[model samples]
Target chain A: MTSSTSSSPPSSSSSHSPSPSFPPKSHTPATTAAGFIKAIESGSKHLLIKRFTLRYPEQKLKFVGDGYQFDPKRAVGIAGLRGRHILYHDKCTGCQLCAITCEGIAEAIGMVRVDEQWKHNKKAIMPQIDYGKCVFCGLCVDACPFYALFMTNDYELASFTKEHLIYTPAQLAIKPKYSGDVEIKIDDHGASHHG
Target chain B: MADLEDRISESQKMGMQIVKESDDDRLMTLSVGPQHPGSGHFRFIVKLDGDYIVHCDPDPGYVHRGEEKMTEYRNFIQNIPHLERPVIHDSTNITYSYSLAVEELTGIEVPRRGQFIRAIASELNRQVYTLYWLAIYGIFLGHSTMFMWPTGDRELFIDLLEALTGARVTHAFNIPGGVRNDVPDGFKDRCLRQITYYEKRLKEYEDIFYNNPLVRQRTEGVGILTKEDAIRLGVTGSVLRASGVPYDIRKAEPYDVYNEIDFKVQYMKTADSFARAYVPFLDMRESCHILRQLLDKMPEAGEVRAKLQANPRGPPGEAYRRVESGRGALGYYIISDGTPKPYRVKISVGSFRNMLALPHLLVGAKMGDMPVIYWALNYWPVEADR
Candidate 1:
């Protein structure tokens, strides 16, 4: 029934009172001029409005919380940027769960044999991540059952060489130092990034 | 090139009366994509007769990576990241339908809060994708200011999304059973505040862009797709709504928490380019209302993800589910052969369906109205090809 009415031209659909008359009441010169004036007025009003662009590199935006984490017992992951992975040496049992998960996804993780022998890690192995191939979906962090893997806010991982993109277990164990404090502040003037 | 020359030479040899030179042939073929500024990553051949388009043939698949075939190699969980890549801006909804289908197959029941949170993320992502589309549509029509305002204001939602799901565009947040994580502390308050401010910004959009005589003059009656033609062409989303069908997948199908939320399917009767453009703006406004409702009705504490086995494999069966994304109704059909990896997967995107209307609508349209008509359809190139 609805299709029958809607399919017909608007002129023939006058029986339906609520249907908006098609051709939209036609634009007269007066209304057209008013529209132009309104558009101009609206555009000019933004001239005094504060610019909202965030100058990156100089003014980095602040993030909430430490980063993304996973609780193996609870079987739920915390929300944050899926940045560089942080490996907990004492917690990771060299199970290769993270590596196994990434194989199907990005194949960014490779379980490498480590020289240091940790009590918890029987195989003396830990996963090394290749950031170049990592899409940062955070499935590897979720695959770690021992709460060993997590993501941090240190996303600025640019390097000069391809070798540097591959972070070994020792490198993954180090917590990155990142301090970005700027955030969006909306005031009467307008919203802008505030440091 | 050789084929064209052969055909012309054959025609000349047959003694067909040629009124003008071959160079002055009435119809001039033009490729409007792959490298064109207006069309993104997609190409279309338009035959122009003077100032009007005589024929239009949309040639999609410049970015096709056989997403369906790629799914056969990965497990269901692994497919989430790459599946969302097609419509990265509206990642949540694209993955939402997949999750719903997977849940149906695997018999994993999502918690109440998880559904609401998923709905909220979907709504937020809808705003994000629509704003991006609007920005591009603005630049397409030479409205630079229109481009800047939406792009800048979109940060509000991006910040909210990054706070909620981690990454900005490629969220990969929605998994098969449910969402990957719970909303962070103070997420509701932050979302509400930004949405309130965003609503105010939307009024400014109406003033400068929608009501502008120039935009209206360029789009009002051009490339009109009547209601019958729209339904016949099988167009979806705002394009379908603009033609007076008023069929929103959210309202009609009511996946997840959509049934709980109260919002009208915003539509227009004219079915012209202006109507197509305006319908999305109205949908965005309605999204704000739906977001508010979802936030309020959301349960305070519940599990965000249903616990699944290390490798979740569904029974041998097929399930199909759809959710309204920024473009239109995005549906996923998955056939699982009692394995972690799907046997066959198919994605039906709104952009692909709406592409049917392009050749239908653009055939008689003016050459200048090409961008206006094309962009107004809310057709994203990569998503269509996927």
Candidate 2:
């Protein structure tokens, strides 16, 4: 196993003395001019490289799939952003599992009675999430046993008022329109966001 | 005039010297409180005489959320989000230790593939945290270019993590039994590409930062904590390694698939600020190597997480598990009373242990070298407070 010892110049002669714990070796500090020139050379090299900033609100990152989904049969979540919650009206049994799971964590999810009638959801109740309270832990998504609750890729949840932050069952069901396609592209010049 | 004379005499008796009259009392007590950008939510009282620091008293806990006490309320699965908050950049490793402890308490064995994925995530997180620390270290030393490069480079890993675990910083990926999800499609190819480019970027760091004469002059011989003193002070992680201890928890304990992956513990003999700063860079390089090995050795397909009951209760017992994180050894000690929630959860962080050496190193050092000495310790204030 290779090990390094004393890559810097010693402060005193006594500190330079040999110890069995480590090899006694020191490197002479480089000439000041050479070091400055090297620093300048390194700094100047980045001049030609492209800027790596992603112009957010204009350019956004692309996701692998529609959103994060969990299969009850498989008992595992698919990888995606832990953003706003999406509820499937047909799939939800109004079991309150998502609400129950979120109670301990964020307390963001609450079952609200809905007007729409679905065969699976006899109680006509679905989770209405308050973005203000949600920590976006995605445990609610994990708690749903019937493929009803999942998180979407749309994370732009900012609202003018606290009242506006709460997404009703219908609002949660309506798929958010987010079309971000920018991804990091590495080239000879540098890495930067590109479509 | 009589009252003023009496006040002056009283102040003098209380060790307070009059500014103009007492040239002998040049010593100044400066509070490097939470307001200071260099301190990072931590305050310290440093007694300075001229440019040299005579005494230092570190006052931590500005960002104290009582993480240990909070764990008693939340169930094992529920605590994942908040527990990862202390070291959010290195969230994977923090939770890795917690998950390891919980797994031991609950008596669950992670599958082979899950172990490989967990190790990969931990290594990636180590890079993320080190890069963040390196960026701050660079800025503290007045190298803006050093700051920009690592921060930009860190996004490559953050993006990779975003793909793998959903969220970027708060992964919440490592549960008690195993990881939350398997690596996404094209994750391997994407990870390989980013890591390859990242390795090339490491050379630039050496040129602009480490090899710079100004940085070397400022940090090289400053805040020297000797090997014996380091051990006596109970320092861990890069600080200990910089002191030539070479005791990495990954190498020593070899949790998960770490023993299978062949790598060396990166350390330096010179226990100065330069070595403390340099060792993390070396460890970052080694993390890249470990990542490569983990990605290579991972099995084709297997269950990522063991499906447990909704509220999985642990038997009456205690489990302590430690993992090698970005700063150092991060361990979680958990006591279960055959309940869904842990009775007492204690987090032993490397940052806290490393901070023990701070007073020792800062004393007799230049006040000008404060930032150099402090940041080089790799002590995260929030982690220490937690």
Candidate 3:
């Protein structure tokens, strides 16, 4: 429409006093056919690269350490996934710290008295979390000074009934069967989600 | 005249006066309803004169979860998860400003290393959110490849975040004291490598999406907002930057370790959809540079979290602070009455501010340019509704 169309972008960068920084831009507009062809070329280039998707259930992602657990003295987590809660019956004192911390946030954890008792747990009460409302934030794990509650990489907590979704004190005591050992590897060619 | 009653009520609710005119014969109204694929968690009404949009009205509050009011019920620390829920994908920065304001009120000093870690998480989250936005922009423009690449590239940062913060998107990582935890071992090396690879991928995005002649023709001269209108209308983030104003909250008002790290704010003189689209791509590149500098300048070892009481409280006062998020300037205003719970918490987000310019840009534009202009403003529906 105007004679200034060809050279305006670059020339204006120098003359514009307010904006000192300008991103490098390609002003030349390729033909409509070429633009479509170039987009196709870039899309096809990815066909040579490996797919990033993980086949869920068949191929679960591997996590490091023994899931997310807190180190009371260190005041930091060991670094792992925030999955289903794992209640350690031996270490639990029935303190209800986890339940107290989760009261406002999710209200997922409830203290239930177990039939069997341990010296550490005088109250015989342990936290039974309802996964239906649990956000898996791992705040409860952080609040547990006694290391009674921790999170494991058992994300498959789906159930048909709401009752089935609630993991009991006895159920939380069981260690989950999660055998995952995959990591995303970046190399010279490109990044790949690898096992 | 009964049929005209609905139109009048709608116009009055929108704060616009309706005048009965013969122009109605030439125009038809269309709603980009909440159920439409193009409008995700958002809806708007647009009147069309055949090929051209004559008037536009944005309807925002479909997903309002009363985030501000809910903050009053929960304590300052318990509210972290709730605060980031609005913009879950870009949680780090949402919580960043909140934490900064809370820290100031309590008179808590974040450790040097903690500040650096917080900045690193912020820069990484920026990439994650921008890439997600770019993906949506691509699909909106009928560029399918643009959608796939950015979505895949986003996993790189998400994986890094998973290792450090334990969760991928809703990282409740930034606490009032500092960050929740330090960067895990091998984090710097992995972050740098992925960022460099991402920089290479950015050029490919230009070739396929930005520089393509079809994309250029559709966007280059469309949705023009001059410098005066951009300022007068009070738009924030990339939309404001695209309109020839270099007003980036990061540069204009530095927060945390942003003052220490060196980077340039990307801006364009042309206030078109293309300029708006290109600004975020350039900002992503700048973020990569900032991330590297932060990792290099980071301290070797220190406490990432401050030793605050179970429920930290502040003296009776108010603190307002803002930070540059993926969209634009995100600020939090918290008034504490020397209690564990905040007296009042108000979140001033970028999406709602940018939405102010939507109607101005949409009117008199061709119907086909709707998606190009709407998304180019970098408006997130949920963020605006919250």
lDDT of 1 by residue, B1-386 (tens): 99977887888687432334646677788889887768989999888999999877788889998999999999889888889989888999899999999999999999888899999999999999999999999999999999988998887789889989889889989887788898988888888888888888888898889878788888898988998888788888899889888676776667887767777777798889999999999989989999999999999998988888988998999999988889888999999999899999999999999988999999888898899999999999999999
Candidate 3 Cα deviation (angstroms), residue A126: 1.3
Q: Estimate, for each residue in B1-386, the C-alpha lDDT of model 2 and write its tens digit.
A: 99998998998797454454544577787889687788998988888999999888888889998999999999999999889889899999999999999999998999889999988998899999999999999999999998888998998889999999899788889998888888899998888888888888888788778878888888888898988787777788898888877677776667988878777767788889999999899889888888888899999898988879999887799999999888887889999999899999999999898888888989999898899999999989999999
lDDT of 3 by residue, B184-225 (tens): 678888888888888888878887888677788778889999
Error of 3 at B313 (Å): 0.3
Q: Write the per-residue lDDT of candidate 2 for residues A9-125, one digit (tens) a residue.
A: 222312324232332233354466677788789889888877889888889999878777786666888889888888888888999988888777788889999999988788999
Per-prediction TM-score: 0.92, 0.91, 0.92
Pairs that collide in candidate 2 are none
DockQ of predicted candidate 1: 0.41
| Model 3 error, position B277 (Å) | 0.7
Residue A191 in model 1: lDDT: 81
Candidate 2: residue B151 Cα off by (Å)? 0.8
Residue A106 error, candidate 1, Å: 0.9
**Candidate 1 lDDT tens digits, A1-195:** 224433543332232333432333445888988888888898898788778788888988788777888866568887777678899888889999888888888899999999988888889999999999999999988888888889999899899999999999999999998888998877656687788
Clashing pairs in 1: none
RMSD of each: 4.6, 6.0, 5.0
